[model samples]
Target: MKKYTLLLVLFFALTNAFAQVKTQYFDENWKPVIQEDMVYYRPEPKAVNGKYLFKDYYKSGKLQFEGFSLSKTEEKFDGEVKYFAENGKISGTSEFRNGVLDGSVKTYFEDGRLRQDATVKNGEEESAVLYTYKGTDINGSLSLYDLMTFFDHDERVKQIIYDGDPKGIRQESYLSEGKAKYYGPDGKLLGELIFDLYGNPNNGTMIEFDFNPMKVSATRVFVDGKEQQLEKI
Candidate 1:
């Protein structure tokens, strides 16, 4: 009798799980669309809650991009979004936090060589490098976001420095006095900061990019007429 009851419960659980999912299709604008008009589509909606898996396709019906969204027709995206070429090679991947691109994002060559590698936070591309298909490194940070076949945000670069454990440094106006102290590789000095006559926080003088999403908090070390804030994010 207990075994029979268990089987009944299991059946209902699986049925409900399947029912929760609903398939959706849409046009380029993400409006409610018919099967023939859809440029984008969703998984049969089941088991998805706050985030829904969504995909856009090329006219050839090859997946052009895929990501998670808050709803069927809206792209308030969260988590990692991926792009692909018609040939199905992954062209790029961008990590999004509440619809804003954040963390380590990269693009690749068809042959799978690294094409672009970047670190971003709060919709800002703090540092990035672009590589030619032939492997020449080019500055593809900030001003170049639009040229890429992805999303766009206006980034004004102050400076870019190569850094580690997957981190890069940038300088800003507020750090005119203070310095950036980096402790890593088991707490050794990776400090690259400036000491103002009064001391404060950064730009070309300091900052890092991480998809590892290191603990970052902006705490004010000093407050003056300008009230410059220090961000250790």
Candidate 2:
């Protein structure tokens, strides 16, 4: 009977020691802060034990960001996240599922003005609403589909999509000289663009054109932004 009791005590002792070790490791990666009588935790690419509220701070001890992370298999951010500017103003907010962006996102300007509002799904943008710094509606509610057709002739305008103007679409496409040429998300031919010598949209200098899906037909000759309409060959 005494031997059994001794073994039980030994088991508890080891368990407590193991728990302390884990706490030490976790504390090493996460910095603890207390602001306005509220405790916040910050992480820096380290391991944890379970669900924890993560936070970041600015040099002046202001809360910079906050979110939740699960420490299983890997420290994956999960749930709604928020970011703050140095001046204690909300900068951005988004939802995350296991580290993948997956929900509505909103951002604000430094002067506490709404800057961007968008929806994300599976780490890709679905729709977005843009606004100017002075709260002007620059681009109305735009979906990835809408941007794919916004500027068919103006590459400079289409380049806004690549720069995350409203909704960011990770299509198999790229921008060249202000022109965005690529396929749609459904693997279909979206459209193409033509640029002049000065990388402007003009029919005078026709370098290349997309005739079919993923097929480029090369046939044209015009030079130096000169105004000369070429005969269709």
Candidate 3:
């Protein structure tokens, strides 16, 4: 009689454990989506309390990206994200806060050299130090949110620094001093220009240089606070 009682108790315990495991498997909301070798989870009820996993795959059956979102619903990303190259190597990694980039982001070259290490705040570029694949500093201590402006679409410039005190509501007048500098991709100073306190290049000297081998190429100076081209004798 005691043996029968013990057997009955063990059977009930196993039955309860199996029921709990089945309950945790997934509700009707989660549907497995398989595209080629990629798999993803899509919540049926757009809003539900749970953690969701996301993934992408390369055509060769390798993982391209993997990340997760934590919330009461599967809305926005709020955790770590990773990316991979076609060769299945990690290419980049970043953290996200509510779907916006909020922390450190690092990228690497195909050869595994660190390409960039930068920070972002509220989805805007805050500060950065650029480098070459060979691990050389192309530009150091770059503060994009503080004092910098790009005229040409390309931003390989070091000149035209904006000195301003952005303290209050009037941001336009905060630009105290303005100066422009130009540099070559080889990291040599090429030219310089001056601008008004308000960042206008109306009455300023512009210097040009020849950096194939560093030297001064030409000079243009503004006179009478007006536009005039100087003719060489």
TM-score of each: 0.42, 0.40, 0.41
* Model 2 lDDT per residue over 1-233, tens place: 99999999999999988654222111223443343333333434344455766666654568878777785324477888899987888999999998889998889878786767777889887767555422234467323222222222223233232223233222222344444343433444444445555666543333333321223344343344344544443
Candidate of highest lDDT: 1
Ten-residue stretch with the least lDDT total in model 3: 166-175
Across residues 48-67, which tens digit of lDDT does each residue of candidate 1 receive? 67677777776577888888
Clashing residue pairs in candidate 3 are 159-181, 160-179, 160-180, 160-181
lDDT of 3 at 19: 47
Q: Kindly provide the TM-score of model 1 when superposed on the true structure, using C-alpha atoms.
A: 0.42
lDDT of 1 at 192: 51
Across 1-233, the per-residue lDDT of candidate 3 in tens digits comes to: 99999999999999988644111122233343344322322222222255556665554557666776664234367777888888878999888998888887788878776656667787876655343321233477333322223222223333232222223111121122456454443445544455765555555455554422333455566653565665332
Q: Quote the positional error of residue 101 for candidate 3 in Å.
A: 3.0
Q: State in Å the error of residue 86, model 2.
A: 1.5
Q: Which 10 consecutive residues of model 2 have the lowest summed lDDT?
A: 21-30
Between candidates 1 and 3, name the one with more favorable TM-score.
1
Q: Candidate 1: deviation at residue 159, Å? A: 12
